[model samples]
Target chain A: MTKQTPLALWRRPTFWPVALLALLWLLNAALTPNFARIEVRDGRLFGSLIDVIHRGAPVMLLAVGMTLVIAMRGIDLSVGSVMAMAGAVAAQLIAVHDAPLAVVVAVPLVVAAAAGLWNGLLVTLAGMQPIVATLILLVAGRGVAQLITGGQITTFERPAFQFLGTGALLGVPFTLWLVAGVTLLVGALLRLTPLGLYVESIGGNERAARLAGVRVRAIKVAGYVLTGLCAGLAGLIATADIKAADVSNCGLYIELDAILAVVLGGTSLSGGRARMVGALAGALIMQTLTTTMLMRGIGQEYALVIKAVVALLVCLIYTPRFRGALQRLVGREVHAA
Target chain B: MSLLRRNIPLLASVAVYAALYVGASLAYHHFCSLRVLINLFEENAPLGLTAVGMTFVILAGGIDLSVGSVMALCSIVIAVLIEQHGWHPLAALALALGLSTLLGTGMGCIIHYLQIAPFIVTLAGMFFARGLALIISVEPVPIRAAGHAWLGGLGIPLTGQLDIPITALVFLGALFVAAYVTVLTPIGRSVYALGGDEEAALLMGLRIGRTKVFVYTVSGFCSGLAGVLFTLYQSAGNPSAGVGMELDAIAAVVVGGTLLTGGVGGVCGTLIGVLIFGTIQTAIIFDGRLSSWWTRVAIGTLLLLFVLLQRALTSATGRRKAQHVSG
Candidate 1:
């Protein structure tokens, strides 16, 4: 009898999503003109390719943190609002304090981390469900953001900040590189450390994990804190991208998009599983699809409807119940074949 | 003690309301006046009505994230029918309600038959309704008819001191109906059972599907009613009306002591929740020193607190049950 290692088992689910994304990229390149161009001038990379990478960066950041959170059988609906709030706070600091670029950047991230800690405490100590606990933030975070900005768009005249969003590294956009770095860091943490095992065990069965002496509450809190930090990072990218902090529109509906990316990447919403590479692939696929639709002159409104439909279809395909129904519909002959 | 335990949400909600009132009164000189109180109720009437309807859905172990969008759709439909087609106000109101109910029934059917998650279904419903509203009209249309104003609260005098909003009266009336249905009806009991344990309720002969459909339908009807009330109070209808109001309704419902996981809650709790939510917003304004942004922060904090309390209580009970079984 041969025993399959855990690493070997993990390889199977991870490969397919990446392969699918690759196929999508190839298809888009073949179909769309100038789809894969990356050019460098004045030490800056620029193109539709880089734009897609930058635009998708925030969501990718979110997907990274969300993957961990969801791996623990929890969802963070407040990421969008947190992003908005962080952006609002970050922009406010820049506006009010004439703070240095680094300090301006650091303040919002800290605030976001605190917000995440608050969510963690609620979930761990208060024992609230993740969805409901995060929801309080989801509902109020935006309002806090608005209040921070005095219900106005806050703009900063910082070139370095804009560069984070728009600059390049070795002809690759800074945002893309950031995504790569974060993904690698998160990937390494999940694969190289005991943290991944602990998260998985805690998610798989909390009681068993507790009995095994796992600090479940601390780990859950850490997941939320990580999520908040990521959200704050995304907020920085978002604010830098537009060169302004627009509280009302920044990071709106991002939570849904991030969740979609995670789900499409083949991560189960029902915990005990984590897929870092799949999330990267999922984020790429989402960006590619959106870019393709928009470049093809698809109306933003219709694009939304299409995205929803595709998301639903993807969910149906991935969902066990829906897959089972599909298999039953196809009958035994197909299975036998 | 059992009664009190069963009604902790109600008690907590009342306590919050009282706290808000006292806080508001101390903060603002005119806050305790009847006129100010009436004004507050009038301002929040539509939201209160929606909260009442939401109580049913949440109690049934489901959520309607589309309520705000549905209200927007209903408002748009009513506005378009009255303003564009010259339909009478009452007829437009009925048609909007009917359409909203149909939408809710369709959502119910999809959830029950397709076995789709309520979260997904309602999220889609939100988009569909919001899209339909935008498609109906891109701009806000003022409802100028005297009859429309009457429906919204144009002519009623409250003790000859201030104009009474018909929306408030309508909201109160809806609350009464919701209270009766939730507390007095077998269907309501069935809803609680469904929330508690669907399979067990099914084995006990509850018509699970029908009960769910009924609650959703009622929810839709209330949303439509809320639309009419909102349009009347605002004296206009915008395609973007009621955006994010669903969160407020959910917040109110949860704060009112209705469990998000469902089973135990009532309209009375919801009434207090809405009032508390409204008071918080009013208090933010009254404080003058606080930013309106604190309204969300305050509500968010309170929501987290209540949800945490509920979680602790439920988990404690669950632990006790586990201990009982192990022992």
Candidate 2:
């Protein structure tokens, strides 16, 4: 890695994601009145920016996990379904019987981890392709969750359980703090440990990584488990916020959002690099864009269209060919002038 | 044993489809009837057509996740033109199919030209199509024109109690064309070559870019046709129509012994796959003990089994190839 100076850091590929987030913030500020305002309403922070961070917390958690997974040249498309399953498990525990709060939270996380282990096993032992292996869960996980909930959206009234979603810390939503904590922890773990280097080597070339004695299978499985844990936490937050488990709609198409956020963070989906902060910034951009669209009274359908355009634009910008073409175009213009 | 090992995937698919049909027939009296058989094809015609397209894209070592959304977009466009804009049904359909093909070509361009992943491009395509469908009409629009209604009503009686819908015929027609293309055409061989090994195919001087774009366009056309079939079946164009349909198409292709990694499947297998899917759905309905959600679970389980089977087959063959080389 190159020596990190302020200028070097700003010129890094990861910096683009943060810059994109800042640009979105500026756009939001311009388009929406008082977008930057933070008021102490009932001792709670209330503003669009705070709301973006709060609403973005779940995706940020997912992106944090997703960044690592994608860095290993693998993807977990089942994360959304896993989220639904986790949320369903939590809601079922709370709504059906008087389960202990600890059990409610622990059971889902454990189950999610187990689900991730299954994905890891399929990929590692069965030697199945990652996309196909995870796809099985993607299709069936929601069905299993529905089975657990008996096809009903189970609602829970436990205030303690709800606190995980709606509670605040120092006038900020508890979810924001949870996201920050998780991001920091995962970032620190990756940055400070040999695991990060192993992941990069494995993704860069699996055969070579194995030859290098990186214990590729174990590292890959661990990456998946970490993603599962993150997804479980996100699911818990979602369930607590709604006070219900919607097995069918909870985390619907969220895999797309998570994957998009990872890609937007300048992490190549083809793998070999991990950028946690960039992924967090990407998540914030998604949240801010959506919040801005909603605030502008744009319909959900239009917002989706805008999101598709943004996704395409971001993808194009990241492509070397597109960048080269743009540079050539500018060069020609300069010469003509 | 070698013969069995060589054809295990194809044989397995054929056996599973047979077993399911036989079991469903034995378990339910009505399921054995000709009317029910015809109804299966009619009900799943759209999925059958979409799977045909999916097979081409997958066989070319790429995926098209936008088929479901493209179908919905086609339905919405056709509905808006014929119902709201008072355009001719055929004209509306032509426009929709053309637009869908254009959309696919655009996605294909991004995939090949920019070298972005197919999944990402098609994912954006999915979002764009679905959003356009919703923007066109949030509410379901009933197509009430006489020509449209007549087209939707086209059904030919097969037996005293059995009738084949136009959509089923269309699906069969598409299936034949896809099968012919995959089995007998140079383009099809090129697709398989591309999927089997992209670098080798490029070195072999295959038109990788054209073939990739062509596959996506074919997928788009099939999706558009499936949309028409769906409109006929439902008699309305709903934006939410075909939600999760792409998964079903992918499932059908995989179950038909089409490797998700591509280059090892054909449309004949896809036909059986669609039939098997329909049979499962029908069995679930006939069982009355399980909810429809069980259908998804069943598909997922089948997909996993097939994927594992493929892995086993590939490894065995790989080992044999190595042995042969060494010997």
Candidate 3:
């Protein structure tokens, strides 16, 4: 592949989501004082923008995986529940079992991936619709998490976990680096291997993909597994940040936000063709919106309304019929002029 | 036998509901009386109404994640109008229902005209309604109007200690209307046709947009009614009420033997599903040893079972169709 110039990169489809993020930040800069200012405190950068990255990391990670699963024409509604379950599992290990940090982290992720395997198998083997199959876990996952914690919030005090949430590398937040590392790793796997192609093929036409000898079931299942892994990591970060795992509220409504990010990134809900960078920018946009709302002293409740409006606008802009109508209106104005 | 097999999901749910109720009644000795039956309907009125509405949406190959939030919004609106402001209870109810219907219409128009996915649009509607409700008030609002008391007092006494609630009557009435619409009305046929094949329905010159909007309107109206029933039953409206009720409603619909893929079920099945759901809750309550979380697990497991049942029926039909065409 030829290297893309900066202009060429901006011309690509991934540009709009980033452009929207930049526009949001610019609007915030006008509203709040020092909104764009990045200060170095204790050798770490501090600002609303940096704070956005830190707060946005979990969603960004979710979007990274969601972009792929959605590209495979499947959705994981259970991500929020999986986050609760993962957090519960990790917290139980840390607080009760007195496990090693690595073990605490690794075990939850494996469990989360197994949950994904269950969703995938339902879809592939039983021929359940992806939405229906995932909905089962979405409903039951939180209950399972609550059961794990004995119907109580589980709190843990692990220095290693806290450091994972707070520690920085060369003035950057650890979560930012974590998001970057996971994105890069997933990006490499998608780009280097046949996984990306297989996803697009199955999403575009499953029968055609099967006729072409693609491992449709395995690939589709792998997509969900990857998503679970990402959600698991997100769970770890969120739990570590709070130092507690509240099964009921951990990662609540996050799957919706992740899906919104994917849609804003210009990925069609009908599936096919994953947008990696677009999803990252979409996550940034959501975080920026939230941060800006807080800065403006707007109540947190209003953020939902604003986010919904913005997502609707993004969806409308992506709608072919809406675009055509806009074009016709513009064409009429040009002719009149 | 074929007919029984074809209606296997409905039969299975009925069987499950019956067995659970019977088993619990035998074990607890206080679960099978007329009082418990009346109480079950009263308690599950909100969920039952939501499930009926959800049935319409799902039968049209659409999903409405907004029902839960819409119900809360409706309850909040009525609470604020009746308590905070001086509006009459009946007037507030009408206004809330109208507002919710308008919200549903907007969502349906967006989904149909702008060609957005129903889930995405309704999810937005969910947040929109929830945020609006939160903006109104986060605190629980009690309905204390004189008229509300009168309405609440109008219950039919079955025995000295047992009576049927107005909420239960409203739910049953709504269920009757929904069953009629889905089974008898031409509009209902259009819904099934649209769900079965949108392209084919369009080719057949069905009023697709109107039917789509009508489905959502029914959903919105029912959810608003559910909220009103819930407020009456509980005597208060909490903004965060029914936070995850959409899932429960959907679970009930799917468990009732209605295919989530659409075009294969009715509201009557949903009634049985709701009974199963309520029975699970009642059983857990009676056992005293089981936690409430088991209800969620039971719901999930039952949903899986029905989905598998639906899957089997769909594949069998598909196979039969293939063989017929080939022969």
Q: Which lDDT value does model 3 have at B163?
A: 76
Interface RMSD of 2: 0.8
Q: Please give the DockQ score of every candidate, comma-separated.
A: 0.46, 0.80, 0.85
Compute the lDDT for candidate 2.
0.89
Report the lDDT tens digits of candidate 1 across residue range A5-64: 666442477775788777877887888888777677787777777777778899999999
Candidate 3, what DockQ? 0.85
After superposition, candidate 3 runs with Cα above 4 Å error: A1-11, A327-337, B1-3
Candidate 1 residue pairs in clash (backbone atoms < 3 Å): B153-B166
Tell me the tens digit of each residue's lDDT in model 1 across B35-111. Answer: 77887888898788878888889999998887888898888888888888888999999999999999889888777
CAPRI level of candidate 1: acceptable
Higher-ranked by DockQ: 1 or 2? 2
Q: For each candidate, C-alpha RMSD in Å?
A: 3.3, 2.1, 2.1
Predicted candidate 3 versus true structure: per-residue lDDT over B60-111, tens digit per residue: 9999999999999999999899998999989988999999888888999999
lDDT of 1 at A13: 76
True contacts kept of each: 0.43, 0.69, 0.73
lDDT by residue for model 2 over A1-337, one digit each (tens)? Answer: 9886566665587788898889888877877899988899888899999999989888999999888889989999899899999999998888887799999999999999998899888889999888898889999999998999999999989998898999988998999889989987988888898888988888899999999889999988988888889999999999999999999998889988899989888888899888888888888888888899789888889877877888888888888888898879888999999
Provide the TM-score for each candidate, comma-separated.
0.90, 0.97, 0.97
Against the true structure, candidate 3 has what lDDT? 0.90
